[model samples]
Every structure is written in structure tokens, then in C-alpha cells.
Target: MSSKPLLLLTPALAVIGLLFGGGLALALLQSVGYLAALGQTTLTLDAYRQLLSDPVFGRSLLLTLWIAVASTAVSTLLALMAALTLRRSFRARPVATFIFQSNLPIPHLVGAIGILLLFSQSGFLARLSHLLGLIQQPADFPALVFDPYGLGIMLEYIWKS
Candidate 1:
């Protein structure tokens, strides 16, 4: 067997291993307080212990879990409803299906970037809101992407799903 395909995939596989694996390793080391730069050579679980002990961290974890569950539930319900509607005989079924499935081809990364650009404080929606007198300025727009409630993240998950 020719090794051409393997050779072609070598670079991509190398990159994936180097970047993804290295990054994860570095993060793990740092999480365990093994950062050499800060003179933290000792491997310890103090960081994790502190995080688990912190009430804020607990609340944040709970909030994240809640958002994940809520978004998944909402997306499932919406998808089910859409599927049921599309299954029924209708004159515009083809068009509706086409519109619905159009986003399936888009990459999640691209969709996430689009969501950030459209939902951020200074994004198109905020600008439009300003022009429509909904808000005096972009700052007046509520935080979406980096909000405390992870609203933008949930929105992206729901949209992508």
C-alpha cells in the first residue's frame, strides 16, 4: 500500500497533537500549581481545593450546569416541534425544510463567532437598537456574551443545535 495518504495526514495529525495536546498538558500542569515561571514547581491540588471550597465557584458551576441543561432542553423541544411541523403535509414544506437545514452546513466555530459579533454590546443588534431608540447607546445594551448568566453561550448552543 502506498504511504501517500499517511504522509499527507502527518502534518495535520502532528499539529493536532502538538497544539491540542500541549495546550491541555500545560493547562493541567497549571491547574495543579506546577507553573515554573511563578516558581511553583511543587505539584499540588491546592488550586482545585480552593476552587471547590469557594462558594462563588460552586455557584458558577451550578449556573453553568443549569444553563447547559436549559439550553439542551429548549433546543430539543424546539427541534421536536419543528420536526413534527415539517412532517405534516404542507405546501411550503420544501422551502421550510430548506430554510431549517441551511444552517446545518455551517461550522460551529463560525456560528459561534457570528453569534458573538451579533450579540455583543457593540454589535449589529445593539446598533440597531440604538437607532430604533431602544437604547441610548451601545453600553445601554445588556451584556450577552460575557454575561453572568451565560445567556449568549446558551443562545449559541440552542442556535447551533
Candidate 2:
């Protein structure tokens, strides 16, 4: 709000903008096949063309979009449900709210890793299940992490959200 503060922040902001902008520019140039170190200066869209033409790439793109949309929808619905539930006057509200908010500050990568560790085949749940005679071995646990539907990723996103 003050000129003095703006002046003081100008240098750091400029440095950050320059570094980030320059790196993005370099990446774009390299993506277009303009790597100077490798002696390739010609810009072309051959890489992108190849990528677009690949059948596997198309499938991967579709799967990624589906996963993103599904996770976002599920997370939004869960958040809405939680908000509605928490807004009411009820007993154990403090405990429930605390438990819900406890993971709010965790980073996405950390939460994802935590989910992986807790849900993987050899994870604690699997071991507990085995110990309880519910599962025969770690492999008997369901494939939640590396499953075909990206359920683990959605779980991480929803939980972190």
C-alpha cells in the first residue's frame, strides 16, 4: 500500500519474474526443437505432431482428463457434504471438525505419499488385515494404489482437498 514497500519488493519480484519467465521461455523453445547446446536451432512442431498422432498418447490424454474431472467432482461433492454437516449444531462437533481440519496444512505430495503408504499392498492396512486373518497375504489386499481406475489418486486428491 506504500511506495516505500513497493520499491523494496520490486527487486525480488523482478528477479522471480525473470527467472520463472526465462525458464518457461527456454522450455518452450526446447519443446519446439531449439536446443542451442545440442546444436539444434530449428523450431518445429514435429514432437507435438508425433505426440498427437500416437494412439497411446490419445488414450493417456483421455484417461488423464477423465481422472481429473472425476476427482474434482468427487472432491467438490464431499466438500459440500462436509460443509453442510459441519454447519449444524451437534455434539462432537469440535472433535469432528478438528479431525477434518487436521490434514488441511499437509502438502499434496506428502498426502499422496501418505495415502500410498497406507493403502498399498504391503501397507499397514494390508498387514493388519493379514494379521486379523481377513487376508491371506499382502498381495491379497486390493490394488488401490496402482489400480486401473486411478482410484488411489482420486482418494489422495479428495482427502487432501
lDDT of candidates 1 onward, in order: 0.92, 0.93
Pairs that collide in candidate 1 are none
Model 1 lDDT tens row, 58-149: 89889989898999999999999999999999999999999889889899888889988999998889999999999999879999988988
Best candidate, TM-score? 2
Model 2, span 37-141: residue lDDT tens? 999999999999999999999888888998899999998999899999999999989998999999989999999899989999999889999999999998999
Model 2 stretches with alpha carbons more than 4 Å out: 1-26, 36-38
Give me the overall lDDT of model 1: 0.92
Per-residue lDDT, model 2, residue 7, is 95
Error of 2 at 5 (Å): 15
